[model samples]
Target: MADSGQALARRLRQLRQQQWPDTTVRQPQLARALNVSVPLISSWENESTPKVPPVSRLQTYALIFCTRRSIDGDQLVPLDETELTTEESRLRDKLLHELLDLRTVALSRTPAPGSAPANPWQFDDGNRIVIVCARLPDELLTRMPYVRPEDPDYIELYTYADLDSLFELHGHIRAFNPGGEVRRRTAKELEPDDLTSHLVLLGGVDWNDLTSDVFQVLDLPVRQVNDWGGDEGPYFSHGDRRFSPQLADGRLREDVALFYRGPNPYNARRTLTICNGMYGRGTLGVVRALTDSNFRDRNTAWLHERFGAEEAYALLSKVRVVRGQVITPDWTLDGLRLVEWPD
Candidate 1:
């Protein structure tokens, strides 16, 4: 059985690598996308870890590698299924069922965003929902999945968490109006007027320009931009305290994400939310922070009951991410403290 599982693991790894043959897909990247741990991804591909991923995750793998319709309506060649063998066909069917079965997904989908409790931050159909994503330079293309094909010069690759955040917010906005307009823009392209809309910045400063821009005004305890000589971050600084992706002993620290939700500095009438991290795992960690019920409730309650939007804007908070999820045993949104803004 283990040998068969190893064969299956190899096939899974092969299929995953085939999606971006020219690019290097690291285990941490896959883990961040699938909302699993790096060790799990390593184990799945290692074939000797004595552990196997669940069928639901295998379905996610298929979605990432097999499904392709183009998010931008650009036509692409479909995966050739006619040549699949009987076993291959059966496996494909199983993956699909695991992903689409209502009974399996009902519990997770039922809550939805923008429902009964109501979104306290003041969003309406009239206001546009702008999703700002980070655009990496051309030099980094070899490490990311291809997002936009037309832009051959700069391959705008977004982590699974970035796409996941976009869809999650889109769903929440669409719940208010099915025909609601949700626009996507890069941080580099953001303008003064764009800040007037309800905004969501997808990635942190390292990859997203918008997040970098927003951090300037908020002055959070953790910042992505700083003058640290030769070192670079999704870096965070609070007075004399500084934390980087590297630990004090020189070993790389586990990823951590900074989540901010409050008012937009450019326009007080609109709200701005940031789900970003120092790295891809940190980025996914921020996404998990926003989506997790415990964090969401505390944050939501704090937004609604503790203080107004602008006050919340002045303060910032952080959550530690171990794998791809937020560590929330003692996490509370109300626990966020104020960021001492310069006069």
Candidate 2:
């Protein structure tokens, strides 16, 4: 992505210099002539910005360059002065803008922070945002069955419902860090230090090994039994409250999910997030909690009060799904617990 920006920047700068070899065309001068921000011109020349200028801005730059180079008194160069046809110019500008847009999308996936990291969801430019997805094993898939009747293949990378919520959440994050580098990796590919960046781990212990390792080692609220997914069935431990689909409760509750945010396990300086559940509905529940505006608002309110400015915390909740959609009305915030990382 940076390569594209660099190439474009090189071409733009080269044109400016070639058009006026004797004169020293400073960035400020070009910015003033084009009526754009000096910083924007600097970004284009230095390749510092993740995205190139928009098509309109590029056109304005060309006009300014042509006006600066004209021998006659006419400020604007006529279309006939250039050998290129009107259609050819339009086609070239369209392709250039498309390339810039593609570069912007690619950069948006990474963490791009300036100075300090304020929001856990947003990061600095050039930083990595690693989203670790779970790939379930065949044996584990056979053992832990999904409570949602419609759910299929627990071991799959991600279900459509999960992707729906994830895609929405990712889009929001991209808005803040358009130049950041985003990546997706499986549990098997992750190293200890890989957790040091802005990390988001999807799925639960039964499928996501990272979740299993964290809960087991950190003494977090969520717990897994040895006979988990067996006759006793999968469940999560939260102090005196134990949430499980097998608990035989009269309530219409069908699944449980966990959402955690905190410092990375390997490096406390970075951020990590966990969105997982005992079943597919539960996973979808976590995704909804992150993306759905109403759901996120309620959860954020609960978090602010419960955690009280803490940097790390966990959210344990349950959701009911009917016909492939999580019923938000039936959702409940079971537990909002703070995480005490080891010093």
Candidate 3:
């Protein structure tokens, strides 16, 4: 967020300086096209201390830069937006919209200086947080009913295997951290910027590649075994003991979940948290520990007390299911915590 202003300045300078190899657009030429003084243009381009230009000028800059006539001859020509062809209009709109977004961020980049607006899920810096979700395998999705376009139900999120966990975590994070930005991405669609911001990976190693990737680099004491179709079911292996789900009557009765928090290995300044379980119910259990209205306050407080300001910690807990509904696990309760870091 601190670089928002510099990003706007860099883009504007790139547009003016990179059009031609030998010649850069002089400030005077841009001033003539924008109908502004050269000194004002210089202020906008000054790298050491850049000034954000007005929106009207940004609109004209988009129009002129997208048009060939602006640089066809010897000078920058003023071109009206109405004169642009379809493709030119498309280009101009994209540039203008990007500039406007940058302007908004640069103008209000600084919020309260501390963690007043931040929750455990949100960052103190008020940066973006992306929740990466696991997508069902194509083979499984291809067989699920009601997913076909021709089907009457035609559920759009049928491909999402962890819908219950996604809905619970996404809404809960947004509600508690209203001042920060929150976004969602399927594992495959993760943007480059997402790796640098605060990230929350949902589901376990078998389905979520992001979770698998993080576990590979992070030095956590626990691991989620992903031996699908093996003799042993999925479980959380911590040191010497294996914590697997308890099944009765061919239905899950209790599940094992791992919740981890630490600074992101990719970007030390940002935080990385993973909520994973052997099954969806397990995932829901750990997420609701800090999001459930009845227990969130107590659960969150316990985490702060247990972990204190530690840079990293992992908690593996047992999630109980009562008549097919997942009951949120309280870390404070005895017998709920199976294993934990900093023990």
Model 1 worst lDDT window (10 residues): 69-78
Candidate 3, 1-343: lDDT as tens digits:
3687788888888889885566688888888878889888888877667787766677788887776666856688866666889998898877776776666556556333441222366455778888888878989988789877798999767767678888988888787677889988888878889888899988998889989898899888998887768988777887889999999998989999989988888799888988898999998898888777666644554565567567788899999999999999967554799988978
Off by over 4 Å in 2: 1-120, 124-126, 138-168, 191-193, 226-229, 246-253, 329-343
TM-score of each: 0.49, 0.51, 0.63
| lDDT, residue 309, model 2 | 53
Each candidate's clash count: 0, 14, 0
- The true-versus-predicted C-alpha distance at residue 165 of model 2, in Å, is 5.2
Expressed as tens digits, the lDDT of each residue in 1-343 for candidate 2 is 4565676677677756775666556666666556778777777777665345654465555444444442224232323326555655565445444333433333333324532233346566456787776754655445655623467744333422245545655776676579987766677788765777788877777667777787765656556553553776677765665667523344335676777787777777777788776766667666666456544433433343345456777766666665556655212222222222221
- Give candidate 1 regions above 4 Å deviation: 1-117, 120-122, 142-161, 176-179, 191-193, 218-222, 225-234, 245-253, 293-295, 303-305, 308-311, 314-318, 322-330, 333-343
Q: Residue 327 lDDT in model 2? A: 59
Q: How would you encode candidate 1's per-residue C-alpha lDDT over 228-333 as one tens digit per residue?
A: 3664544666676555654445433454455666677777877787766565555555554435543443334333333433444433344454434445322222
